[model samples]
Target: MPEKSYPMTAEGKEKLEAELKNLKVVKRPEVIERIKVARSYGDLSENSEYDAAKDEQSHLEDRINVVEEMLKYAQVVDATSIDPDEVAVGKTVTYTEVGETDSETYTIVGSDESDPLNGKISNDSPIAQAILGKKKGQKVTIATPGGKFDAIIDKVED
Candidate 1:
C-alpha cells in the first residue's frame, strides 16, 4: 500500500523534523553510550541496565522510523492560503449549534496539531467535514456520538 500523506503546518513540520534530528543525532548517541556502559557491567542476561538500555534503543528506533515515514509523505498545508469563507486547515471557524444559544470557536488544523481543548480540530474530522465549503449564514449538521446536531456558520479566520 502507498504511504498516506499527512496534512501539516510549516511549524508543525519543523517540530517533527526537530524531534527526528534529536532521536537520530542526540538520543541515538546517548543510548549507544548507555549501552556501552551497561555492557561493561558483565553478562547481559542478568544486567537490568543493559536490558533497559536495549528496550530504550528499540523504542528510539521505532520513533525514528515513524518520524521518517511521516516526513516522507508530508503534505504541507499553508495557513496563509486558506480562504476566510472556506473551512481549510489552519483556519479558525465560529459557529452556533442548534438548541444552544451561545456560539463556539474551533481551528481547523492537521490531525497532528489538533487539540480539542486548545480549540484546534483536524480538518478530516467529522466536525470539520460538516463545515467545509460552507459560508457564513449556512447551516451544517453532523453526526456525532451525542447524536446529530445542526451548526450555523458564523465566521472563519486564519
Candidate 2:
C-alpha cells in the first residue's frame, strides 16, 4: 500500500518542524534526566516516580514518531497558487447562512492544523468538502454530523 499524503500550509509545516525539534532537543533530554532522577529513588518495582517517568517517556517517543512521519509525508500547499475567488485549502472563506443575516468565516486547512474553535477547519470536514473548489457568491449545502444547512459564499481570501 502507498503511504498517505499529509497536505499542509507552509505555516503548518513550520509549526510541525518546530515541535519536532523541541521534542528531540528539549523534551528528550528532560525525560532522560527525569528517568535518571527516578532511578536514584531506589527499587524500580516500588517506585511510582520511576513508572510515571517511563510512561511519560513512552508517550513522548510515540508523539515524536508520529510528528516525524507526518513531516516526512507533508505536502505544503501554496494558497497564492489557487484562485483567490475560489474556496480551497489555505484560504479564508466568509459565508452567510442562506436564511440568516449573520455571517461566519473559516480558513480551510489540513487536518494537522485544523482548529475549529479558531476558525481553521480541516479540508476533510463536511463543510470544507462541500465548499472546496466553489467560487465566491456560490451557494452550497453542507451536511454535517449535526445536520445540514445552506450557505452562500461571501468572500474568499488567500
Candidate 3:
C-alpha cells in the first residue's frame, strides 16, 4: 500500500518544516537537559520532576515523528496554478449562508494548517468540501457535523 499524501500549500509545508526544526534543535535539547537535571536530583522512583520530563520528552518525540512524516509525504498545492475564480486548496473563499445577512471568509488549507479561529479551514472540512471547485455565485448545500445549510459562494481569491 502507498503512504497517504499530505496535501498542503507551500506556506503550510514551510511552517511544518520550521516546527520540525525547532523540535529537533531546540525542544529536544531542552527536554534532554531537563531529564539530566532531574536525574541528578537522586531517587528516580519518587521524583516527580523526572517523571514530568520523561513525559514531555515522549510527547515531543511523538510530535517530531508526526511532523517528519507529514513533511516526507507532503504534496504542495500551488494557488497560482488554479483558477482564480474557483475555490480550491490555498485559495480564500467567501460565502454567505442562505437567509443570512452575514458573510464568512476562509482560506482553505491542508489539515495540518487548519486554524478555524484564524479563518483558515482544512480542505477536508465540510464547508471547504462543499465549496471546492465551485465558483462565485454558485449555490451549494454544505453538510456539516452540526447540520446542513445552503450557502452561496460570494468570492474566490488567491
Candidate 4:
C-alpha cells in the first residue's frame, strides 16, 4: 500500500520543519536533562518526578515521530499555481450561506494546520471539500457532520 500524503502549503511545511527542529534540538535535550535530574532523586518505582518526566518524554517523542512522518510525506500545494478564482488548498475562500447575509472567510489548509477559530480550515472538511476546485460565484452544497447547507463561493484568493 502507498503511504498517505500530507498536503499542505509551503509555509505550513516550513512550520512543521521548524517544529521538528525545535523538538529535536531543544525539547529532546530538555527532556533528557529532566530525566537525568529525576534519576538523581533515586527510587525509580516511587519517584513521581521521574514518572512525570518519562510521561512527558513519551508524549514528546510521539509528537516528534508524527511531525517527522508528516514532513516525509508532505505534498506542498502552491496557491499561486492554481487559478486565482478557484478554491483550493492554501487559498482563502469567502462564502455566504444560502439565505444568510453574513459572509465567512477561511483559508483552506491541510488537516495538520486546521484552526477553525482563526479561520483556517482543513481541506478535508466538508465545507472546504465542497468548495475546492470550484470557481468563484459557484454554488455548492456542503454535507457536514451536523447537516447539509448551501453556500455560494464569493471569492478565492492566494
Q: Candidate 3's residue-wise lDDT over 50-158, tens digit each?
A: 9999999999999999999999899999988988888989999999999999999999999999999999999899998899999989999999999999999999999
Residues 25-77, model 2: lDDT tens digits: 99999999999999998999999999999999999999999999999999898
The models' CA-based lDDT, in order, is 0.86, 0.94, 0.95, 0.95
Off by over 4 Å in 1: 1-3
Off by over 4 Å in 3: none
TM-score quality measure for candidate 2: 0.95
| Model 4 lDDT tens row, 10-59 | 98999999999999999999999999999999989999999999999999
Question: Taking the tens digit of each residue's C-alpha lDDT, what string does model 1 give over 1-158?
Answer: 97699887787789899999999989999999999999999999899999999999999999899889988898998767766687777778899997888999998877777889988888788898888778778889977767889988888887
Better of 1 and 3 by TM-score: 3
Cα displacement (angstroms), candidate 1, residue 140, comes to 1.3
Q: Give the candidates in order of TM-score, highest first.
A: 4, 2, 3, 1
Ranking by lDDT: 3, 4, 2, 1
lDDT of 3: 0.95
Clashing residue pairs in candidate 3 (N, C-alpha, C atoms within 3 angstroms): none
Question: Over 4 Å off in model 2, which ranges?
Answer: none
- The C-alpha TM-scores of every prediction are 0.88, 0.95, 0.95, 0.96
